[model samples]
Structures are given as C-alpha cells and as structure tokens.
Target: MPFTGQLEDGRPFIATLALQAHGTGVVGDGKQLKFWIDPWLSTEPLKYKFPSLFCLEQDKRCNVADRIPDCNGSHAVCWNWKHYPATEMEIEELIQCHRLLSNVSLSKQVDRWVWRQEDGDGYSVKDARNWIKGEVLSVNNSVYQWCKWIPNKCNIFMWRASLNRIPTKDALLHRNIYVENGLCGLCGEVEESVDHLFSGCRFASGMWDAIASWCNIPRFYVFSLSDVLLVLNDLPYTAKKKDIMYGIIIIACWRIWKARNDKIFNGSVSSVTLLVADVKSLAFLWFKCRHKEGCIDWRNWCNFVLPVM
Candidate 1:
C-alpha cells in the first residue's frame, strides 16, 4: 500500500509512513537501507506530537539555551524540527513494567496460592470459649466483620461474657445473683439458673404469658430466650422486620433482668403489667418502631399485661 493509504487511520502512523517515504540515513549500519520502521513513533504517534504542540501554544518554558538531555518524563529535542520518538526498547521496557492484568485472574492466583491459611482451627483462644457458648461461629465471619466496623452495644458485654466463658446458664444465674434468699425470689422455688429461671420458673412464666397474649403468639410458643432467638433467626424475608424482632428479644431479656434487679436491690416490686410496659417502652426506644404482632400496635402496651397479672 502507498504511505497515504495507512495515514488515513491515524496521524502518527501517517507521520511514521511519511518519515519512511523520506528515509535516507541508516539507524546504525552504513550499508544502503530501505524505509525503516521507527517502532516508538509507530505506536500512537499523535500522542508523541501532542505535548510539544501544547508547549508551542502555551508558555514556552524550555528556554532553548542548553541541550535538553533526554531522561524519562521530559522530552529530548535540539530545535523545533528535530525528530526523535522515545526509544523502541525503552518504550517496550516501560510497557513491560506497567503490566495491565485482570483482577479476576490475579485474585484467583492468590486464592489458589493460599491453601492452609484458611485451614483447620480458625478460632483463637479468645474466640474459642464463645465458640462453645454459641456466640462465635465460622459462618458468621462476614456478620462479625460488619458488626465490628460499626460498633454494637450488645457485642461488648456479650464478648466480655464470652471471654469469661460465662455459660449462658451461669450468666442467667448471675441475673439473680443478688437475690440473697437462696430460693427462687419470684416463685419461692429452688436456686435459679438460665433454664429454670427463664423457662420453667413461675416469675418469667407469668411475663411470658402476658407477652404471648399481647402479641397473640401461641401459648405453646412462649418458650425460652433461645427459642425466641430461633424464631427471630427464622423470621421471614424482611431484613427490617428481622432486626426489629431481634431488638425485641434484647429488650425482653433486659426487661426480665430489670424485674429480677427490682425485686432484689431496688425493692421496687412492681406488677407484671409495669414490667411488660417497660419491655414495650424499651423495645420502642431501641427499634424506634411500634412493635406489633398481628396488626395491633403495641400502643396501650400496659393493657396487654394488666389482665394476665
């Protein structure tokens, strides 16, 4: 093809072709040479001319006094017409160093390289105790990361309880630790534990009865806090609803503990109605939404319990 044929696509290619058309001197050898390939200029020749064209119109900063020695970013030129594109081998070296590779492939390489890094016994001693009590689990890695990114109030006490290896049963016992009478303070039974106090004991049973009727939750379903957690975990597709339900569980536990504290320390022996009211209030404060079970707003929350107590 004639030099002009290829020039139609790009100015740099055209410029290189034009140089080839007018070639006279050999690059190194004195033997007669035909039109030569300036590899550097052939690759994006228009880009090569741009900065000088820019320099011509804008401030002519290079005061043409000294021979502008060719380095890297700065250009090498003797006068306006002197011809030199960055060297072909030099450009190739630069291109090699640059290296535009795909992220997918790179990450795959990294993932394959790491075998045992993700292997057995992922838990440290710190997280091990919690692993036993059902707090820490490998499946919840993402959840734990997100939880730490934005601090959760529950995580601190929960983790402290975790580190102390506080058995859920033991912590539940501590809920009534201040009760000096040794017997069940609420129902006058044996020493309290998590299962006994919250599940079987009469005190919490009364609270659950009121809660069940208020929410229209089945009487059979009014079980322990773990059962409540199972319900929350199994909540239907809505994330907002699930979070609110979880908050309800937290508030319920807190309110139950507060009732225990009131009986022991405060001497504020309130009715079950008051306790249920506190639960609803705390739920609203925590979740910022009126928690309702079956289209009934927990508005007159006190009314939910007054009759049951």
Candidate 2:
C-alpha cells in the first residue's frame, strides 16, 4: 500500500519544511548578505527581481556592503549602481528598485535569516505545511488564456512560438548554430525572427489582413507575438464570439507555419485564399468539438456569424 498521511513522503516533506522555515531578513548593515543572491527585501532574490541589472554587473558575487556608499559619518544609505538599464522596461524596473532600496537606513546590527511565514517569526512544521498548500493552490491563471480554445499540441506550439523557442533560422543563429542564411522562408526578405516571421513579413501581414476582414474585424496590423495574443482582448463582440475568433487566430498562425514548412521542404506554396480556408475549417472543427453550448454550422462558420449565445 502507498503512504497516505500528511507527512507522506520524506524528501519533498523535508524540502518544503526547509523552504518555509528559513527566510533572509535584512537589517541594512550590508555586511552579511549578497546584493543579488540574498532574499533581503522580497521573497525572491534580487537577481530574479532585477535580471537585466544583474546581467550587466561586472561582479556577479558582490555583497551589499560593496555597493553601499558611506555618507560622511552619517547612517544614510545610498546605492552605487554600477550599470545602467538597457531598455525602457529595464529602466522603469531599475528606478523602482532603486527607490525601494534607497529608503533603507543602515544599522549597526548584523543581517540574519528568520522564518517569516510563521507567526512570531519562528519556524513550525504546521506553518510550513500550510504555506506549501497555499502556494500549490495559487496558479498563474493567465497561462490558460494561451491554451483555452486550441488543441493541446497546438497550444504547446503557440506557447513555444510566443517565447521564440521554436527552431526557426534566426533562433538557431542566436544560439551560435551556423546556418546558410537567415532570410525568411516565406517572404525571403529580412532576417526571419519570431516577430518578422509571424507579423513583420509582407506574406504574414497579408494573411492577418485577410483574417481580420473575414472575421469582420477592423483592419489591424500585427507587429509581434504579443500583439497577436492581445488582438482579441478588446474586440467589440460577445464572449463566445470572441472565443471563436481566438481559435481562428491560433489556427491561422499554425497554418502559416505549416505553409512555410511545406514551401521549404516540399517546394509547394499555398495561396492566401486556401490558407484562410484552412484556418476557417480547422477553427470550426475545434470550436464545434470544444464548445458544445454554441449551436453552429458550416455556413455560419464560413461567414463568421456565430449563433446567439
């Protein structure tokens, strides 16, 4: 028989207990903890919170004391940021982190680790168990938005495509893998990055335009994967219709990828009309199988008029 008690497994049980029982508490003396690796302010280490800044740092293992400035015999603390932010998002995050840390005052007391998840700042097995339970139940629900109306494999493909993890020519080049050329297979113009292959290329842009017109949506342009994902968010349609539209967009992306591969490997090119028809057919099949409440037919699907909810 299998174990079924609260402390059922030994390895995971001890690991969870250890994680909840220890948290670094910073007293701002800057001597005992690292600036990047220690969990001083937030639950996560500063390295994760400020990844861009951490990457540009010359010294990866520098401690907090090394970055703090001594202000003329006073207890005031100042950050000596060694590197500048590289992008707009990085600049905003860096400013926020600087403002948060600059407010801290250095003390003579040494920094120490404490059990922050428990009451009275002490460790308890019961507290650790409860903390683990809470964390397990808290999911990043936004992930479901990517996989909602598509098949499992297509959803996984979309997720990887969004992250630029697909083995496209440009992605291979970025990983130091040598390729003959980086031009897009579909358009044969410009380097085939994730954004360019999906939206920036003329071929892909034309497909998006056809899709928008078919769905009766206004003529909108897609510049990146983020734009594709967020295009249906604020549309003027019912929730069910929006779900169908989302499915169509996902199918269109898959079809574009398929057509690109077919052209490269099989020396065959599909026209825009045929590609749009494939998207409509596949989307109709998926929506019909997945959404049972909506009574839809082939004519309504082809015309993009979803039945009343």
Candidate 3:
C-alpha cells in the first residue's frame, strides 16, 4: 500500500489495504468486528461474497454480535434487512449466508486478528512487502518474470496473454459470442487462438523473424505464447541483454494486438515493416525513459547493440 496522506498530527500515514486483505479476524465475542465488512467467517468479507444481502442490510455498521442474537443458551443468526429478499438470487444468497453462520461457534475469548498469509498470528514486514510487490507464486504454477522496464499495460497484456485470458477470436467463440469468422484477424489463415495470434500466425511469425534479426538472436520458431515468453530464458546472453530482449518481445506482442484490433475495428492494414519499426521505436522509447541504466544511443539501439554493463 502507498504511504500517501498525513495524520491529523502531521505524521505520515500508511495505507491499510494490505492489512485489510491479509488480516483475518477470529470471532470470539464478535462485538468489535463488523459482520459485513470484517473477514471473520471467510477469507473475503461477506460484503464482497454476498453483495445482494449486504445491500438489503439495514444496519451497515452492524457487528457480528449484533447480527447473531443469543437465544437463551444458544446463538441464532439474524439479519437486519431493510427489505425482504424478493429475487431468487438474493434468496439463495440469504440461505448461503445462514449456512455459513450455522457452523460458526462463538467463544468467550476476545476477538483477535491473524495474518492469514503466514503460519503464525503475528504479521511480518518481509511477508507484507512480498505481498505488496506481487512476489507470491502464481496459482497456475507458471513463473512469469514481470519486466520492470516496460510499461505496466504491456506487462499486464503479456501476463494475460500468457494465461490465455485475453479475448481472442477463439476465446470469444468459446464464450458463445457470435463471430462471422473465427480466423486470425492478422493472417486469416486459421482460428485466432491465443497461441496462434501471438506465435503461429504468419503475421506474428514475420514480426518475430524481423525482431530476431534486429536483436541479433536466433530465429524463434515458437509453437505457443509460452514459447514466445520463455525464448529469452534459453538464449546464451547476459541477464541484462535478456531483460532488454524480454521488454522488446512484450512491446512487440502489445503492438501486434493493437494492430489486430485496428484491422478488425478500424479497417487498418497490418504491415510487417511498419509494425517492426513501431516495436523498435516504442521499445527504445519506453526502455530509455523507464530503465535507470538506459543510456544507449539511438543509433546503437537501432542496430540492437547493448552497452557493456
């Protein structure tokens, strides 16, 4: 989280986004924790999971203890809804809410917060820093090195493309969206799947060939998007050169996607020479501006020469 605002007494204030995300409150008395806002019952707060119910809830600031009433010896869950649940979805959410509360058992001990990310109840600055930096391992088990030199939009696009999450023609078709033709917008040879668009398509292949020649690297005959991303890893180059190549590759991919969109939406023609030139100039601009050690001359950059580190 960003340390932005100052306190009332003029001290710097640290944002609690990390705290609220990783902090899991253990309900004991439940009086101190807000039922809808606090993540006591699950990893996510009920407000996010049950938005319909939260919206209908009359007492927005009601605590867990306020929502759950004591019935003689046992505790019964109660909701202070402004209006009764009318929609089927809302009714289902209400039922699920009750089911979530049915297994919860309150204790006499005071409610406490625990860091859900780590093993112990205590929070660690190292862990928080890692979480903030997005250093945590991916759920898909794919190790993607986020290029710091490139723009975040490029990195994000590459990440999504790596995960096959981008809305390619084939992806749109799979999602039941109507498409006159599912062939690649760039080449129109085969179906526009993630792999084909970024790697297998004739347009993408030419782009990669030109880039490889320009970068003084071996031709990357990739079959999938993963191959395109991991090609730099196998290259016999220094870490710094690999970093530069990775950023260039990401920019190329971003430009390819933009070209495809322009073709489909704006009737723009895709050109290999123009596209490669755009990639080279953009990669040069973004790298020189964003990277700390980016003092390479434009002439050397045009010739793909890396200054000795």
Candidate 4:
C-alpha cells in the first residue's frame, strides 16, 4: 500500500493513510483523497451521503483530482458512471453530489491528515484516549452525564438505555440471538424494548406512578427513555432538588430494568409496589454513601424533602 504514487486503480494517492483512523480529518490536496470514500468534502464520506450516486460510479476508487482535474478550468468536473443516472432519485443525488463538489478546488500542497480532537498540540496518547472514551460513551449526539451519586453500573446502564443499546428481548432478536418470545417480561404485552420496558409497559407505568407520588412530582407520561430523563427539568424545584430527582429517576429506571431481567431469567414476577420500594431503598443507600456530607435524614429522604443548601 504505497501512498506517494498512484494506486493500482489509477487514483492519485497521498503520502499518508492516517485519515482511515478515527478522530483524523484530511487537509485535502485532492491528489490522495478518494472522492467517494474519504471525508475530504465533508465530515462524512461522500459514498454515504449519496449512496445512489456512489453505486453508479464506474471508478469507485477515483481520487478527487481525477474527478475534478483542473478546478479552475471551464469544464472543471467530469463524471464516470457505469450508466448515467436515469431515475429522478438518481438525478437528484447526482445534482446534490455536483453541488457539494462544485466549491472544492485542489491545492498545490500534498494531502495530509491531522488529529481533530486536539487543538494546536497535535495528537497525544491522552487526547486519543479521551476522544475514544467520549465516542464510546455517546449516542445520537447525546453524551453521558456522569452521576456520582449513583453506582457506576447504574450510570452505565442509563447511558446504554438512553441509546436503546440495552439487550432487551427485541434487541436480542435483532442481534440474531434466540429469544423464545419478544413480549415484555414484566407486562407480558408489548415487545420488550428499552423504551417500553422503562417507560411504556403497564408495570413500568405503575412503578413510575408510585415513584411520582412518593417523590411528590406530577405524574409524567413518557414515550421514550430519554423523555423520562427530562421530566425533572420542567419541575419547579431548587437545583439541588432537581439533581437529587435526576438520580432518583435514573435509579428507578435501573430498578425497572433489573426487574425485567429478573422476570425473564429467574422466573421472578415483578410487583409495582415491591419495585418502587426497592428503588427508594437502593437510591437512598447509594446517595447516603456517596453524598459529600452523608448527613441527609432518612425521613426527609423518604418524604422527598431536601433542605435548600
């Protein structure tokens, strides 16, 4: 895989293949950047942005320089398609592709890749590790907010649930795992999904109702797990109270997921009363141990009363 010369496919190549790695962005000279495969035009590779156009391309590995030989020339661009776009969709995609590449002009400098996670300092082991951690712990542009009050396992579970990454029955089935049934283990009704198990199932709804009454918050109706997490934001409470409520909500969801697993794997039936009690108990224990002062009264906690600090 020589990088300096032309590839066997006749695409002009660059001297570095570092762009293939994560957290690297290209400073395009066009000679080395694959027009369809590299993220030279945008943050995403062109092949993904215009799948139809990519399929029609005859030279899949053509360089940006090969496609747009002389950017300043009158006829600056050329198309090499297996067959020219015929359908309306294909034509639309081709139009979009051309529009995107229209502004791109080649530079005399050689193409090079640079680390995007660091600013002026370039790449380092620490920045790479941090970038990898952030990428792994994020989903759909939502980063995991660590809750020190709860156990690390609960925080991790909440992060996974937020992404619908939990191995619910439906998720398991999607992964081609053998699931005898996809029905909710707790409610035995709807398909077991991260959202349904934590927010939509009848048992889950009952548990949330109990939790709401215990915490003195208005009953919340949520269609998704992420919605459940945001319910505390609209509440009229002090920041400290809201923070505590956030932990309670997280712990409740964690308990709900645990109950669902218990039912499926241990033949344990879920009771809303028992589940709510467990959420309260477990949350109290975690918060008490992890709180800075560890001076919160159990009665006030049970009553959802936190003195303004």
lDDT tens digits, residue span 167-236, model 1: 3334444566443455554555545444444555556666677665665554433223445445545534
Whichever of 1 and 4 has more lDDT, that candidate is: 4
**RMSD after CA superposition, every candidate:** 32.9, 11.9, 17.9, 14.8
Clashing pairs in model 2?
Answer: none
lDDT of 2 by residue, 1-309 (tens): 111222211224344334433666565567766676667777777777876666555444556776664464453434444456668877877787777676666667776667765355567778666766655454223353664767887787787887678888877877899977888888786777777777766677778889888888887656577678788888788887777777777778878888888988899988788888888888878887877655689998777777753
Model 4 Cα lDDT, one tens digit per residue, 1-309: 222454334444331223344434354566777777777666678877887787677656677778887646443678898688999989998888878866767768787666655354767767555654554444336666667788889999998888778888887887899989888888886777887787767777788788889878877766568778878778888777777778888888888888888988899886888988888888888878887745677898899776644
Overall local distance difference test of candidate 2: 0.69
Best by TM-score: 3
Enumerate clash totals for all models, in the order shown.
0, 0, 0, 0
After superposition, candidate 2 runs with Cα above 4 Å error? 1-144
In model 4, what are the clashing residue pairs, if there are any? none
Index of the highest-lDDT prediction: 3
1 or 2, which is superior by TM-score?
2
Ten-residue segment with the worst summed lDDT in candidate 2? 1-10
Reference-based lDDT, each prediction: 0.39, 0.69, 0.80, 0.74
Instruction: Candidate 3: give the clashing pairs.
Output: none
lDDT of 2 at 155: 80
- Candidate 3's TM-score: 0.55
Model 3, 106-140: lDDT tens digits are 76778777788554656788877776555223323
